[model samples]
Target: MDKKKISILNLAWILILTASLSFSGCRTDMQEASKTEEIFGTIVSVKAYGENAEEAVFAALEKAKELEKIFSLTISDSEINYVNQNAFKDAVKVSDEMFYLVCRADYFSRLSGGAFDYTIERLIDLWGIGNDWARVPKISEIEPLVGLHDYKNIVIDSQNHEIKFKTDTAMLNFGAIAKGYIADEMKSEILKHGVKSALLNLGGNVLAIGKKPDGSLWKIGIANPFNPSSNIAFVEVADCSVVTSGNYEKYFEEDGVRYHHILNPETGFPSKSGLAGTTVISPVSADCDALSTATFILGVEKSVKLIESLDGVEAIFISENGDITYTSGISKYHFKELN
Candidate 1:
């Protein structure tokens, strides 16, 4: 063969190889994998679409279980249980992850003016709304526990990674934000495995990682407080978290009076802020989770103002009268009202 003919043949072979590689890449990118597990007191699911989707989802689920062990108050040997049991007597050293979450919880506690409290475990136990024992307590029984709902009682030493309580009666519970925190951690784990698109639904708290495989935003539904079976609205989001706190979840009726789990730390009873539910959207899942509860307690006007003041935070407040009020930023996300 001539030299020119030989060079042309080599170029053709190179093109064929390149096309084969590109086609293989596309096939891997379209693959999807998902896994669901009951952990952290809720059903957590992780889904990913890409070459490493299965491994990423599995790893994320494992991470969620690890976090549950560290944060679960009911777990006998968990770090949180240790702190709750011994923090009052002596400063209990906690894991770095636990210390960071406690600090963040305290920050939000102060930010929401005690509306979102971590030191309300005593109050939660008294009401037992979502616990094995669910019932309404007498006024005298709830009144004493009211004073124990103070977040100020928590003493955190970031330098030493220790936590202590000022009062022996005080307890710590991350039930409000644990799922969100675990979801955020799982997102990190999924991305580390080279998953560019994923969705994590920790119970009702949803976090979308990057965009969908089709390059479209993820649509998350906001549950209707009055009718838990239906959605009141939907928000399109990407690389963000949508969290809702409502009276409809974990509530029981006694003598025609319904008592919910989202209690006011100040009152030791379910909040009566004239709001049915609050949904918050933010880049941080934990922040969205805490703010959802805070905004629900803050009511419509205050919650709207608070969300507006914070950068990259948006909220939807559904009133007891079935009216919806949302922040300006959420409008661009194409929020649709169903009812």
Candidate 2:
């Protein structure tokens, strides 16, 4: 065969092989996988579409479960439990991961001025709203613990990754922020396995990475505080998290009075912010989670002020009377209010 003709034939074969590989890549990019597990006191789910989707989803869930073990106070051997037990006695050395989360939680605690405090574990235990022991506590019992919710009570040594309590009564609980952190971590793990698109619902918190398989924004529903089974509105978002904290999430009625889990550290009682629920949208799940709780406690006027100062963040507040208020940034989300 002529040399030129042979070279041309080789080039043709290379082109054909390249096209075949490209087709396969496109197919795998659209493959879908999903998984769900109960963790962090809620049902968490991971859904992804891309290469290694199944393995990635599985690994992501496992990673979140591992994190839960570290954060769950109910877990006797959890790092948080250890810190609460010994932090008052001596500086408790903790993993860098735990230290980092503690730092983030502390930041929010200060930022919200105790509205989103993690040191309110004693109050949480006293109310026990989510457990069988849920009830209202006496003023004497509440008075001592409310002051402990101050973030300054927990001391952090960033250099050595150690934590200590300035007050012996202070306790640490990451329940408000850990789920969002786990969702962020799960998104990271899924990306490590080459998934380009994923959605994570860590309980009511929703996180979307990239866009839908068809390149549309993810639509997340904001729950109606008055109607827990229904949505009050919906927001379309991409590459962000939508987290909601509401009085309806956990509560019990006593003497026709409702007591919720989101206690105001200042009062040692459920926040009476006149807002039934607050939903926050941000690029980071942890931020959205913490902000939702804080803004809910801050009420509409203060929340709007706080959210406006933040970049790439938006919030929606549903008042106890079904009035809706939101930040100016929320308009960009294509928000639709349902009647």
Give per-model TM-scores.
0.90, 0.91
lDDT of 2 at 325: 92
Clashes of 2: 0
Cα RMSD of all models vs. native, in order, equals: 6.0, 6.5
Query: Model 1: what TM-score?
Result: 0.90
Model 2 compared with the native: what TM-score? 0.91
lDDT, residue 63, candidate 1: 91
Instruction: Please tell me which predicted candidate would have the highest lDDT against the true structure.
Output: 2
Question: Which window of 10 residues has the lowest lDDT sum in candidate 1?
Answer: 142-151
lDDT of 1 at 220: 86
